[model samples]
Target: MSAEIMPYVVAGAMAGGFINGLAGFGTALFALGFFLVVLPPFQAVAMLVVLSVITGLQGLWIVRAAIRQNTRRLARFLLPGLAGIPIGVMILSVIDASTLKIVVASMLLLYGGYFTLRARLPRFERATPFWDMLVGFLGGILGGAASLSGALPMMWCTLRPWPKQETRAVLQPFNVAVLAVTTILLALKGAYTRETLIYLAIAIPAALLAAQIGITVFKRLSDTAFRRLLILMTFVSGLVLMLRAVL
Candidate 1:
């Protein structure tokens, strides 16, 4: 990459990494704005998945205990989500991705805005494995169809009263897994040219450091605060998605 573009690469990495560390997701939503400014859509996306997965590993280690405790719960969401990915990819040939993004973004704005303004988040203490599975499956479908894997799952998780670690245990790993698959698919499609690798070298370290800073802030937050943050992020993420699709 030229020196002219290096700033965008570093800026994208830090923005993406900080949010991922803070919330255990959202590397793409935050990073793409900087990236699309200097790089093509395909190359920008290629770098994002790689950054997300690498930075996500740090988040995974932080939530390891919660993950071990709720392995079954995670699997209920993950396995079905994985199964839905290929089908979502198939749907891509037939669907208008931009339109689908708008629909999902509108739902996010409606749900996120309403709940964010309220005094409290909704609760679902019951362990509904079936619903969890359904959300995971659809999250995977969205991931495949429009690169929106986290939208559904984040919305679902914010409803509950789970501790921050438990919530991160679900959201962090789910995003990493989906994005890992995306990275592989992109690799097969030759998205990772030599130039992409050069950009990744500079981006990765910046992303890692930013993620650590985000994790520090995340660690200090109360459970309620974290959930509120996620809700607020949902609203923000939806707005970002809507703008990217429209403009």
Candidate 2:
């Protein structure tokens, strides 16, 4: 990349890493904005996923206890999630960046609006294996296409009766695992380029540093406040996505 672009990417990586480390998911959203301006949207998402794996690995380690406790639930969603990854990639290969921007932007807006209005919303009545599989499948597809799949199944977990920690733990590993597969597929499909690797090297550390800061913040935060923050960020991210699409 050019010198001027390099700085923007590094700044984006730092912002993405810090937000994700603090919030557990905003990395891709932030990266999306930065990369879309610097690269194609699909390429931006693919590169972001690679950087996310590096950052997410740190998150997984910090939440190891939570992961262990929710292994079974995560495992339940793995197969379907894995199965759907290629579908997302296939879609990405065919669709132009403009279409992806519009579709993802619209989805984020609708999802954010709904969640913001009803932070305490319930899950689908039939959140059984069938629904889980279907959701996982769709999430994987979207993930492959846009790297925004992290929010979908997580929304399902949020409405469950479990304690917040348990819910978060259950989703973390699954999100990481799904992203891992999606990243690999994207790389194989030619999303991984020399510039992408260079960006990853710089961005991954930013993610780790930000994650540590987040851990500190998380330790200080109350659960109710954290929930409110999550809702607020989701809404903000939706607006950002919409703007990216339209502008």
| RMSD, one per candidate, in order | 0.6, 3.3
> What are the per-residue Cα lDDT tens digits for candidate 1 across 43-82?
9999999999999999999999999999999999899999
lDDT of 2 by residue, 103-188 (tens): 76666567667877874755443447777667677777877776667656755654455544655565556677877877776778
Clash pairs for candidate 2: none
| Candidate-wise lDDT, in order | 0.95, 0.69
Clashes (backbone N, CA, C under 3 Å), per candidate, total: 0, 0
Off by over 4 Å in 2: 39-43, 90-108, 114-129
Pairs of residues clashing in candidate 1: none
- Alpha carbon lDDT at 178, candidate 2: 79
Segments of candidate 1 deviating more than 4 angstroms: none
The best candidate in terms of lDDT:
1
Candidate 2 contains a number of clashing pairs equal to: 0
